[model samples]
Target: MDCLFCKIAEKEIPSDLIHEDEFVVAFKDINPQAPVHFLIVPKIHIKSLDQISKEDNALISHIFNLIPKLANELGIENGYRVVNNCGPDGGQTVDHIHFHVLGKREMLWPPG
Candidate 1:
């Protein structure tokens, strides 16, 4: 219940929401790593991708289905990077299931 993304999704905390529906919300990252950086999060408080169950498959697909449209809306049609850090070792600072949409610059692989 004390989750940041959950608060944002519930409108308890203000975010620059670019997209939203009954199940998910998209908004700019507070600390951007690129010129175009935003986060796509589920309205339901999902701790991490590994925590997703078969029952959540539809929701997950729905989230992925919206990515391309969101990228275009953010003007990243040329290309973009979608990242989901899973755990502490994976550099996940936020304990929530979310995807980072980064663009506007060429991203290098094996990310330093």
Candidate 2:
């Protein structure tokens, strides 16, 4: 596929990787919104959260399980926000399903 996150997962594109396993890959966001900002993306190509199926449950669980560990390792355990923007109106720029792990600063309410 022509997905940007897919290419990063495949190592076809360079990224400042933070963590990786068989199920997912975490990397620093090129355009960080917070002092600590990174992305956790599934190795498998998933269009978006709304597209997830029952078969993807395990993958989703794995992604959640990895989030805290990554946050602690990245020293953002004190506070952080895990955001998954849905469709275009929801501000999902990329088609690939990915979680934005942002922290190191207080996240304002009603995020834009």
RMSD of each: 0.8, 0.8
Candidate 1 C-alpha lDDT tens digits along 1-112: 8999999999999999999999999999999998999999999988898899999999999989999988888789679999999999998988999999999899998887
Cα TM-score per model: 0.96, 0.97
Give the count of colliding residue pairs in each prediction.
Answer: 0, 0
lDDT of each: 0.92, 0.94
Model 1, stretches more than 4 Å misplaced?
none
Location of the lowest summed lDDT over 10 successive residues in candidate 2: 70-79
Global local distance difference test of model 1: 0.92
Error of 2 at 81 (Å): 0.3
Candidate 2 off by > 4 Å: none
Candidate number of the best lDDT = 2
